[model samples]
Target: MHPDQSPLRARSAPRHVPPLLLDIDQMLDEFSRQAVRAEFRFDPDTPAVVTVEFLAERGPGVIWRIGRQLLHRGLTEMSGFSDVRMWPTLSGERPSSWLLLETQEMEALFELPTAELAEWLDATYRIIPDETELDGLDWDGFLLGLTGGPGVPGE
Candidate 1:
């Protein structure tokens, strides 16, 4: 088991949304879906990032770190670009959201319950509000780490 899949890790996360795997059969023109286990983690120390781990049955889980803002905005409308995209969807009986994760090898689509995700996102905001994400960041230390003792980028 991967360290990120430990019980303690899941218990420590602020929110964990149960995800559904949408199986799209384009050749047959049919759509089938089932529940899948995935963990969503938010760290107050990195207020702007959200971590998602897709658990596997016999191996380590797949992890992706997404921007919290992008997920929040996606609840209402389409957002994201390139490898990640999310948009609102009203299908079946529930108003859910569609998350598209693309890589060079393949792409996967998951259906997320909008209400639950929105509520979870709201809780994150209460912990660290928007626009104040950088309130406590140490700029000098960050720059120094980036440039290896920096006064300027090239100097």
Candidate 2:
């Protein structure tokens, strides 16, 4: 293994919070019920959507994790959207248009406010996807972070 690339030497999460992230703390307090949906897409321009709804309020935090595993299996087992690079986009301060294209699941859930379409295209997510089930999917983690708001846990 390279001296610079060891698992034990991995960088840590930033102590300073980023400015772009929505007030996740507020969302956690506003509501307990929550869910996440996924979508798969075949077309580079558009793709199929897949979703796995979850109930964080009904049980401990594990339900969300289980649902995530379910989503992974569901995408691998199904066909339709390409499962190439799915959720890695959200890590970016500003995701690429190419990244946004794969988010059929999120788009299905929440339409970009018509007013915000141009801005949404230009900046970061001041707004996010609603909630809807999609089919097939690429294996990207970008969509996973969208699981904030009413469903996700918080400070």
lDDT of 1 by residue, 1-155 (tens): 57659777666635433343332211111366655666777777887888888777679978999899989999889999999888888666877788888899978888777777788778788768888877889888888978789565566
Tens-digit lDDT string for candidate 2 (45-114):
1212222122234453211111222223222232124422222212244422111123335322111112
Looking at candidate 1, what is the lDDT of residue 153? 58
**Worst 10 contiguous positions by lDDT, candidate 1:** 20-29
Q: How far does residue 149 in candidate 2 sit from its true spot (Å)?
A: 33
Best-matching candidate per lDDT: 1
How much is 8 displaced in model 1, in angstroms? 30
Off by over 4 Å in 1: 1-30, 143-155
Score each candidate by Cα lDDT: 0.75, 0.25
The residue pairs in collision within model 1 are none
Off by over 4 Å in 2: 1-10, 14-66, 78-155
TM-score of each: 0.71, 0.15
